[model samples]
Target: MTEPKTRRTRNGARLPADQTTPRYLGENIEKDLREVSERTGGGTMQSRILVAAIALFAERGYENLNMRTLAGWVGLKAPTLYNYYASKEQLLVEAIELGMTDFFSYILDGIEDVPREDRLFEIVRRHAGYKMRHRLIARANDRLIDPQFARMFLPEDTARHFSGRMADYRHTVEELVRDYVADDALVSPKVATIALLSQCDRMAYWYDPGGSMTPEQALEQVTILIRRMLGIAA
Candidate 1:
């Protein structure tokens, strides 16, 4: 059998040979922290801490992060950090909620005004754009679906709320797929919805802002691929 071909980003990070497979998360912590700091500049101190916490949790794993380390990243003493977030778990929950809130708001904003036929494409475009622009929070959002993390780390109410929000998002996509493919007998909305989201979401693992494609170009290319996948005519 011929070996599958892999490609490297401009930064020389190798991606999976098969585009359908999600790539493993790997990033330079120092670089990510610097970017996070720059992005959160002028935000409230609490907001800065939350952003730092998300970046740290995403890159270092929730179990691997501690209050002291998180505080140090945000220039706070451990006890002072507790004034903002009672515990690391609280911080995690808040971070997840904040990230999801921003994601949903960004993607859904003005979607209602879009022509019905173009709504799915708009959503996909926004999703791809957000993933590229907010790499750290996107990675942190990915952790919400990890079986181990949900089962072991999340509080019951928080887990239930997150799961419900995710399900609602999936259902929204499925509805869009159903409407988009209403005339096609062969496409299953449920399956197509999963495929479409999987394609866009996986970009978080391999996309590099410094890569050959600018964010605008990348979003266009991704929406084009998704349109082709869904058999939408240009």
Candidate 2:
């Protein structure tokens, strides 16, 4: 029997000729893959590559997604793909960070202008809307930051950065919950914030754009549920 030749990139990175079986990132991979397959028509080459990378990572898991596979998705040679992202780790980090930043900004933008009484609802609406619109990205971001995966796959500094960002967002939500809770409400704001966010975030896993419920109806129902949970009157 002849030994199969191992392929190497210009920088001596090994390229796997065959796709490796996908590893489990978490329970969300199956749902993420479904959403990834439904997406199409990203704007520019670099943007399209990023979009494709997210989809591939969701479909193939971190170890199974190779440069050659990603490059093929973007219609570029493997070495040429390196010009955009030097390594799989670099690409994964960038994709995760970009998605987090965008998700945060989308939920926070114009929040300062919202009336005090309406601010919580506004933030909840945006959060739910973004998840419905970008479910695959949301799922990928969530999985990549899982403590087990983060500690094992991401550099310590990168993991810390994501943790800090997540903490900041949580604190922001806590403050909002504190302000919105009724004067005599018995709930702790921090606990309520966690519960509220968990409810909103889970939408990414189950929300169906094509289902009987429209995004508008879904957001309205979510906001109503949030209000009742917070003891706010309808």
Candidate 3:
């Protein structure tokens, strides 16, 4: 397989784009911040900085970016930028936090009030849909935030809450799987969880619009796969 291309974090931190670290949501956040800034005729300095950083980082991978360049984008001196972010790394962390929160929030929205039997289907469909909708950001997160890269920035480098949120949300999914057992569904909880994640993860590598399966169809098929995995009566 070809190696994943390099991508920049919203904070302009250089990392691989083939992993899972949340940062691109800052792009959306930045856009919203800019819109509010324009409409209200004012925006927080920090918000402008994030918006600029999102653009700069996305255009130029982190390796080609630096605090000075990022500061210049926001019309700030490099030192002034530090007033908002201790380091570019911290800023990247903030971006990642934004991205992850949005990611899971959509999943929660998808599953909300969904019939219990359809909950898993909705979760996977929404997840795949969200990722497809924001494929670039998703790819960047996947490439950049995999286990090793994340370890490089934990504890001392980021807020405890932001750093741990991904793990916490992931455990939440596991809890949802356990619910299947509680309902006396005939699935092995372990297999169901693993299968679900694996199936979803494959979307990142193989989502093609014109390749026989529409996203709607793909989701329906996966939903049925999960139902079968759970041994729910077909």
- Candidate 3: count of backbone clashes, pairs at least 3 residues apart or interchain: 11
Report the C-alpha lDDT of model 2 over 1-102, residue by residue, as the tens digit. Answer: 453465665667664443322223323334433333333323456655665677566555687677777776556888998888878888988777766766
Per-residue error for 150 in candidate 1, Å, reads 0.8
- In order of listing, the candidates' clash counts read 0, 0, 11
What does candidate 1's lDDT look like per residue over 1-234, in tens digits?
Answer: 665686554567554342212122444444444444454443567766776677667655676665776776667778999898877888888877766776788788788999988888889988877777767567776876565788788888888888899889999888888876664558677888889998888778678888898888878788888888887865
lDDT value for model 1:
0.72
- lDDT for each residue of candidate 3 in 1-234, tens digit (9 for 90 to 100): 664587666676665343221234233334343552343224767656654454445545444556776775566788888888997766776656555655677678546588885676667788777665555555555644555546654455464565477667566667778866554556566656777777776675576655898887777676677666765655
The TM-scores of all predictions, comma-separated, are 0.78, 0.78, 0.61
The TM-score, computed over Cα atoms with residue i paired to residue i, of candidate 1 is: 0.78
Model 2 TM-score, 2 decimals:
0.78
> Can you list the residue pairs that collide in candidate 2?
none
RMSD of each: 9.8, 7.1, 8.1
Name the regions of candidate 1 deviating beyond 4 angstroms: 1-42
Q: Which stretches of candidate 2 lie over 4 Å from their true place?
A: 1-42, 182-185
Which 10-residue span in candidate 2 carries the lowest summed lDDT?
Answer: 19-28
Model 3 misplaced regions, further than 4 Å:
1-64, 67-86, 110-112, 156-163, 181-188, 210-212
